[model samples]
Each structure stands twice: as structure tokens, then as C-alpha cells.
Target: RANRDHAAGCVTPVISQNSLISSIAQNVLSINPFQQMINEIIKQKIAPLETRMQQLEEMVQDLQERNDCLNYKTNDLAQYQRRCAFHIYGIAENKEGNKNAIIKYIGKVMGVKVEDSDIYASHRLKQNKQGDDC
Candidate 1:
């Protein structure tokens, strides 16, 4: 049997060009335009986004607080629909129209109270029994 050799005098080449082509076909192109995109984005867009996000978070917190207050008032109103109490005397606010709002808001919830009468309505909660441990 005669062994045919190339001009370079190479031995039997088991791995040919087809195997290299197959390997290249299996891989995908990973194109990265910038080496420091994340840093640049943080410097450019992220600061504003973080500031706005902080503002949004603060607004959400304010809304939640106002919502809790409104919920409490709404529940109290639902409990007593027929009559309402207006507590006007205690710590009268210096603001002109704020007093009216407070009076009206309170009146819609409870029965009704005058602007000057000192009527005490205390809420006694059920105390939890102390355990023997402490």
C-alpha cells in the first residue's frame, strides 16, 4: 500500500476541516460593545432612577399612612351610620378651615358633640394575661 503525503510531508490527518466547522456552528456570537457598560449606566441613568425611586418610595409610604387613617375613619363611620359626633372643643387647631374638617370628619363617625363640651370617651383594651415566666 502506498501512503500519499502532502507537500508538507504530514501524517494521516484524522481530524479534518469538517470537525472545526461543526464546532464553530455550535457556538453563538457574544458581542460586547463596551467593557464598562454597567459603570456608565450607573453613572448616567441609575442616579436619577435611584432618586426618583426614593421619591416614589416616600410617596408610597405617605399614601399608606393616609390610607390607614382613612380606613380607621371609614370603619368607625360604618359602625354608626344613623348618628355622628363632632368633637370640637379639645385642642382646637389654629388653622381656619382645618377645624371645620376635623369637626365634620369626627361628627360623621361618632354620634355628635358640641364645640366646647368636655366629654371623656376612653377605650379600655383587653390586657393579655402575663405568663408565669416573667
Candidate 2:
């Protein structure tokens, strides 16, 4: 500290980085006004990021469920068996759509309703044709 001549006044004061860091740490530790303002801004900014992460997780789960259903559909039934003419007692090329449509028809014939063909087609009777030998 430099003393001024005559009236005994001080000269310009010097500031240090260490004192600045100490003051900031104290303010944050003590819940001062500046710390409160910073906390509010950080919370508001992070909230949207949290919401988007939740949405992305839900989308991945849905995709996984759909993939499992598709795998069951392909594995459960053969192409030829999926398309046998019940009324004619003969085999024919079946449309992927045709195989799906007959499930509803047979379900109605037996007084039942099927919602998921992937689940229904796994059954032997449903995937194959009616045979007099059996």
C-alpha cells in the first residue's frame, strides 16, 4: 500500500485472481444472489434435454417390439402351407395379404376373433389346410 502525501490517503489498490476465485467459491457455497441466478438458468436449460432423452428411449423400445413381432411372423409358417385352398383341397401360391385375410375368415368360422396374425399363425391348424385324412 502506498500512502499519499499530506492528508495520508491510499493510492490505487491491486486485485488478484486468487481473491476472485475465493469470493466466487464463497458465494456459491453460501447460496448468495449470484449463485441462485446461475442455478436457475442451468436448471431451465437442462429440463428440455431430459425430456428429449426420455422420448428417444421410448422410440427405441417401440422399434424393438415391432422387430420381435416381425421375426415371429416369418418363422412361424411356411410359404406353401400358408396358401392351401381349403374348399378345393389343392395348393396354390398365396399372396402375403391372402394368408392374412384367411385367418380372419377361419377365426369367424370357429366363433373366435384373432387380433394379431403373428400370434395366430403359429398354431398348426391355422397355418395349414383342413384335411379329410385327419
The sequence of per-residue lDDT tens digits that candidate 2 reaches over residues 33-81 is: 7778999999999999999999999999999999999888776666546
Q: Write the per-residue lDDT of candidate 1 for residues 10-71, one digit (tens) a residue.
A: 53243555676666765522224353666687689878988999999999999999999999
Residue 59 of model 1 has an lDDT of 100
Give lDDT per model, in order.
0.58, 0.64
Clashes of 2: 0
- Candidate 1: segments with Cα more than 4 A from true spot: 1-38, 82-134
How many clashes show up per model? 8, 0
The TM-score measured for candidate 1 stands at 0.33
Q: List clashing residue pairs in candidate 1.
A: 84-110, 84-111, 84-112, 85-107, 85-110, 85-111, 85-112, 86-113
